[model samples]
Target chain A: MSSITSSKKHPLFWVLLLIITVVTLFPIYWISVTSLKSPVEVISSRPTMLPQAPTLENYVSVVKSGFFRNMFNSLLVAVSATLLSLTLSTLASYALVRHNFPYRGNSLFLVWVLVVKILPPVVLAIPLYSVFIKMGLLNSRLGLIFVYQVYTLPYCIWMIFGFLKALPETFEEAAMIDGAGRFYILTRIVLPLARTGIIATSIFSVIAAWDEFLFALLFIRTPSLQTLPLVIVNYIGEYETLWGELMGIGLLTTLPVLFFSSYVYKYYTQGFSVSLK
Target chain B: MTQNKYQKSCFFYLILLPAVLVMLWLTIYPVLNVFTLSFFKYNYLSDEKVFVGLGNYIKLLKENLFMEAFRNTLVFSVLATAGEVILGIALALLFYGHFRGKKSFMIIAIFPMMVSSMVICAVWKTLYHYDIGLINFLLRETGAQPVGWLIDQSKALFSVVIIDVWQWTPFAFIMMQAAMGSIPEEIFEAAQIDGASYMKTVFSITMPILSDQIMLLIMLRTIDTFKLFGKVYALTQGGPGNSTETLSYYIYREGFSYFNLGKASTASIFVLLVVAGISFIYIGKILKKD
Candidate 1:
């Protein structure tokens, strides 16, 4: 036990930690380096660990290929999905936690939500395609946001459910005794107390919506309507892969998520613990 | 007062209505639609639909490609989940106690999982390239023959699995570390005071205590990996003779690429059943706790 506690002081431990860190981060480093290399250097038989002559030509080419439009599409869809799902789940989970429904409706709803979360999106995408086509939602950003609820809504419900359940009911009860209405109590007291959980849930919702590929691939037909992931995949063609441009866009797609996760790293991990519980 | 209580209850239900309606429209309606669609021989482009009466299911059962995709999905899910959880446990144990730079180390370590799977796959695809890949470059530097990572049928699935493991192992590590943090330090101290060796203490005390969290982690990983689509779509595209074909990819091709909506619907039903079954067990466990 003493030895286990003291192991951090040993050189072998630090060496092992450093090696694991490098292996984990090597892909990000490689993409950054690859994205900086010129096209001719990108295809060299001997890959350079470092760019021989660093250039932003690949970034410029990617931008010229309409990367920014796709990025804006991704941002629009992700933000809307996050906001929509967050609002819906917060209200629903609050109701489920504070007020009981007959016939185990609350638990049954949660069970169904979990099932939707677990099932592959492809399963739902098949039928949703037909419905969207009929509704004239194909190639529309609003449809993506609606369909994204399948991913984001269930998650928000679960994460918020966990947070709301952990909150003490006494505050709400006291507020009610003071003639505060349910809506006012939820907005002022409960929501403020669960601020960390809401932020964490919103972060995850944005990430899931941003990274979504299959539904966007299926529903969105117009090239201009395509999201970032759709554009990133287009760079990898059968006959020729634009390695530098692909890596360039790949790095760009990763930056927002990396920034969010690192910014609130503590709440990010806390979100995981809450959901797992 | 009685009317006020009734209104209060109505308000709760009112707030719950939107989520219920959205879920019903999205999940319940679509699932039912898939079931109905599975009974027909339909092609979207042709605008033709004929009642098939389980014909699609029969065809999928006998089709080699569908079976291969099923098997590959299972193998990928099992192998990736096992690899991640095992490696995750090891990393958790290694970094158990307080150390300088732990916060930064953890943030960097989890970078793989935070990034989009498409981006991660792009990086790995380049690294797995036969001629100009960094892995092969290192192999050549070490006087070893260059291997066909994505081109070879036999090794292609494993290569994809390696990418999955590399990208997701940190998730398992985080889960395991959080679980480990919850265990009381006094237990380990008690084991030490009783003259138990480090390995013995870990096996006896820590393993038994963390068994529940471990099971939960495994189930979570298994469910996620079973939907393995983005990695295969980006890396192999079910390439080199259907070596890495997965259920989701198969459904995608049938539904979209080929426009065989009936067959795709049947495949979707199959996936839905399996995923639902697994998640029910998980849900039962979770709800039981509540």
Candidate 2:
């Protein structure tokens, strides 16, 4: 409150904010510009303050060399994981939220889910690697989807748990009074209200699958099935570097998440990740 | 009606069955698998799974790489987490008393927190490069000798810590701000009336109230940092003589790079124990409070 009073007279806050915003955005903007500039312009000791003739050469190379296919593979896997996790989490959250069964000590169980999330991903890597190898699930999209879904479903469950806590059970009770079945009410009444929350959770899942590298790098071996993160990493050859192309792929890769989150980031769906991370 | 009720209950569990089973398969199975594999000297390629009970674990106990990775992980997590929490609180306090550009500052603050780790690493990797890098360029202008950020064995872990601080301080800020907002204004005013200065009010009244939330942030960041893979992978690849290799990175190299299945599994159990210990303390407190 005092800040509201002081902000009018003191412009220092404005200056500080502007400086921070510029600093926060500089790397992103720099990467974008670097992706556009030619090899010469990118590596020049002097700043290429602005692209003189911005070109899509780097983007073309990334695309024509079949990088987009890998990107599509990531998109497919991320979407599948997000959708599956959301479906399961929504149902579990609904039951936990609206129903109080004889054995309804659900909060303790939810903490178990949180513990699952806290378990280091590294711990599972070794054993899961062997499991995938034995099951012939290595380098398969379906297998990757299964892995990624379990990775973030606990998060999905936790997110929906928080969302469901604030919503009154009366709404579902009202639907029950109107002679609607529990499943019907869940689908038609409660879910639509929780749409924003669900969307937020799905975005988190998608980004987790998309941006994931270690699992993708370890599990995938076939060049045809590699995800975009692997492509970006491997494109940095064992020899002479390709900075421009790396930045190009990096921008292209995260663009969807960036666009989606920029629109959706303000939602109250920030979860264990923001807290846990 | 009784039969219908039982049937509905069965159906509910059935719906839950897939998720529960998958969770068991992916999470529970692998964790148990790590324990089993730790006892066996197994190779992924050679198809020779010989159970040499506790042999791999015994070897890892004496391994220098495991020792270094373990010590480095503890130091890195402690230093980085403490730094992030303090800096995060400072950023939160600086922004707590809002200004004209509060909304804008917040959006920018959360911006870094929202971006992918790999992308952030790429940018920071460039910025930390010794030759033709922004950091060294700034230092040179100030008449300071350029230092090797990622290459120097002693400094690599600190360099990665700095990257983490840059990306994650916003998280601490948001949580701390939320905790601060919970304190009543009159309590602060009452303290002020008792001849407390700003520092005293903050230290005596505000900070004590904020201690639990600070503890929560510390637990979260420390566990997260212990799982450091992206920054190390991007910045150094655990290079310059394995100076920056944490347990997680060691697990990766052992499991993937070398395919040392038994050893990797042994290392993973070590990670699992540390992670479980941290969560038990923090999550136990959180659950108990509820």
Candidate 3:
């Protein structure tokens, strides 16, 4: 009786695990499979579970449709914004962590940062539209990069602040005693120790900017300047969707993020854990 | 020495000044600008601006489309957050102990969350297609009638919610699993030795210990789901008669599509108040912990 019960429980566990694994991953599998199918097979009444004659035609066509230009736009904006936000946030968070400001300024600043993080992006976008127009930043890559700071800056500050707070002050204090200047100590001692956190924060920031759509849609008018997401949406037109090409662009756009995310999977999970605390 | 100390403080502020200035321009000034814009009759295209104190707000309140959008946003937020958190706890429990292929399985499990949401939505959009979709194809295989997943008004919002739950459950699971790892194994071992059933141990021992983490997860997911725009825009475009229209999407259409900055600003203010109320509760809890 005991053996039978144990045997019954084991298979149930495996079955449940298999169910979840399939449910969680099936869309990704379907996307890849659909992307490989020819346009005729993609929209057929009887959808092929596997492309009978798998081809790279969808990818070719999508690329021919100026996919690379959009991808380049996305890459440029994401990278530039990530670098800018990371630099600003690292300096600010370091100051917040290491120095005392008057009137409980550190805590007040942190509270404000948290509010900015929580506020919906659309709230800011409404006003920012006019602001950008006045500044002549409309329809420019530089404008998009600057606007993205609204999302990335507060996040980088908080994540980096957590990491800086966790580091022991002894190392920095000793460096100060040795007459090392503050900038020298910061460059030599603090940054290296917080390298993991900084890398993790930057990767997440890049992903956020890369995926940003609402701002890009509103700001960029020129077909040449639009980002990957805008192009992906264009594939799903009001009249007809180019499913094969849509999936092709979708998979292509995701590959870079997937590669980077897997590389930092450990830190990604750790970042969430840190945020929880 | 005091002069040197003062100089060092000045250096700190100097390094911090740039971020402070950008944030002030980006967040503070825009927020105030949005508030002032909400009171006007403004149109970007024609460059018309007239002060209509609270007229935009009153119009939005009476607008059925706006009301429907509000209701849909509430429903979507509640359902998506609840689904993600619950499924997350279950996944965490299922994968609690060590097993063969655990690392690979965990990595695969989290892949959905890492991918761009647009890509995820595009994939699901194909799968949710009424006639040609894989989901409908399967239903026919089992001799079940096909359901309109995204096209049906009753099912559109729920379809969007399912995609959100699919993508984000891993996030909640990762968080829950991390918190679970912190629990000493000895406690579970003690419970087992005391003849506690698995269900009993989970409910009594594990849950009480995990309540705080669970609360934090709910707040985080709530704040995120409240800002649901990209998914709706990509999938339904809040279609099939406004079933999936969210506040963010509503604002996007009003502000961008119609160029009605006045209406958009008013809707944005409504979203801001609700979000502020929610975040205040969350911040209050997080601050108390500190």
Q: Once superposed on the true structure, which residue ranges of model 2 sit more than 4 Å away at CA?
A: A1-5, A8-15, A45-54, A98-109, A177-179, A237-240, A260-265, A268-277, B182-195
Q: Each model's fnat?
A: 0.71, 0.39, 0.61
What is chain B's TM-score across the candidates, in the order shown? 0.97, 0.95, 0.97
TM-score of 2: 0.91
Off by over 4 Å in 3: A1-9, A261-264, A268-272
Candidate 3's displacement at residue A259, Å, is 1.9
lDDT per residue, candidate 3, B42-144, as tens digits? 9989899999999999999999999999999889989999999999998887778676777778888888987788888888888888988888998999999
Arrange candidates, best lDDT first: 1, 3, 2
Clashing pairs in 2: none
Report lDDT (Cα) of residue B125, candidate 1.
85
- Candidate 2: docking tier: acceptable
TM-score of chain A as modeled in candidate 3: 0.92
Model 3: per-residue lDDT, tens digit, A1-277?
A: 1121122336667888899999988888888998899888988988887999999999999889899999999999999999999999999999999899999988888888898889889888977888899999999999999999998999898889888888999999999999999999888999999998898888888988998988998899999999998887777654255788888888899888778644555654554434621
- Interface RMSD (Å) of candidate 1: 2.1
Deviation from native of the Cα of residue A51 in model 3, angstroms:
0.6
* DockQ of candidate 1 (2 decimals): 0.66
Instruction: Write down the C-alpha DockQ for each prediction.
Output: 0.66, 0.44, 0.54
Across residues B50-157, which tens digit of lDDT does each residue of candidate 2 receive?
Answer: 898888888988999899999888988998898889987876666665455565566656667777777777767767778766678778878999889988998988
- Candidate No. with top lDDT: 1
Q: Write the per-residue lDDT of candidate 1 for residues A1-277, one digit (tens) a residue.
A: 2455543467888889989988998999999999999888888999988999999999998899889998999999999999999999999999999889999999899989888888899999888988898998888999999999999999999989988999999999999999998899999999999998798778778888999999998888898999988877766654255788899999999987899656545754554453441
